[model samples]
Target: MSKRKPQPPPKTFSVRPKRSLRHTLPFGLLLILILAAFSFTSYESYASLYDADYVGVEVCADCHTIMYDRWKDSPHANMTHQPSPETVVGDFNDSSWMLPPEGQLLPYDDELPAMRTFTEGADFYMALRRPGTADFTSFKIAYVIGYQYRQTYLTLEEGGSLAPPPPAMVYRTARVLPLLEPPREQHPHSRRFVGANDHPQFGVEPVLCPVPHHQLRHSGP
Candidate 1:
């Protein structure tokens, strides 16, 4: 045989690394962190329902039907409403009322009293002249207070202030609020000297006027 070049010895490959935790440690830690994050997120999501204690007024209707029926129509039910055609009972079709709508209209700088101006188109507004200001500022009526006897308006103002009342003549330094008034009447009578116990109009009800709560619950009254 021709002197063949000596073949290089067969090269040997290194054995595969052992299947140990060291190689997969990073992946295991990542998986554990992901699981922990999911658990914490789930816990936080489910723990948020403890905010309000009452279920709602609807739930109370089940056991207190009479109370619900009476309450549903009472003035208390109409205590607050949004100012709209459905709730507002005032005349707002370019109608004007004197500033002291209860009294005579006074002469303002523009010959129109600083007291009154409002219009109703798509919305209602109170165009009133602030005491010191020369011009009138238009305030948008945001809410209606009641609908039983009469309705009053709440206006939104700058800086989220609650209007107290329409400035009759002067605006108070305190926070403003909605202008509302209950219908009131007073009849003056001659004063007569009388004993304390002789108070006729000041009738007193016994300490327990209405029946006890438990009795009311059992009986329909």
Candidate 2:
């Protein structure tokens, strides 16, 4: 009986199989996370290229009111303003001065001496001349006014119906003008002359600080 019971127990055997997850949830979630990370990285790389508009100071004011208000009162912001009896600072009615005509020497010769003079006009006007053409045949001062160096000169395009100066004459004299002496550095109160590089400290350099800030230097070969 013992031998038969042992043989019967030995014949009955049970086997348990390994359990495995058949769902693709974990793998799918990992793939989604990887795709999301790649998309975020790509977006950051191309952000600058998408911003192409020239958002001036006015646009910045919309978001940063306080900062814009401070900048508005700054000297840099008030560079451009209407020339009124109060806002106008230069001597508009001062004596007229002679400016060398095109292709003429600075010192002025007896024959072809100073052929042009800058005089005060009845109203503000900008003097515009085409490049290479000394004959300022066509002139119009309607809507443009700008500042060159420290002097205030109106644009010829803003005169509307107001008559323009002669081909050689760029402006009119509100009154008789006197000749100005050549600017000297020691004076410290010299009137500005266009294209004059006399004073290394003053002129356009100190006035226009931002221009030289990022001026590109050319490398010689």
On residues 73-101, what C-alpha lDDT tens digit does candidate 2 reach at each position? 76555543344544443433422333335
The parts of candidate 1 lying over 4 Å away from their true place are 1-65, 99-110, 117-120, 131-134, 167-221
State the TM-score for model 1.
Answer: 0.44
For model 1, residues 46-120, the per-residue Cα lDDT tens digits are: 334533342555566899999877877776565555666776666555544333444333345434555443555
Candidate 1 achieves a global lDDT of 0.47
**TM-score against native, each model:** 0.44, 0.28
Q: Top model by TM-score, which number?
A: 1
lDDT of 2 at 87: 40
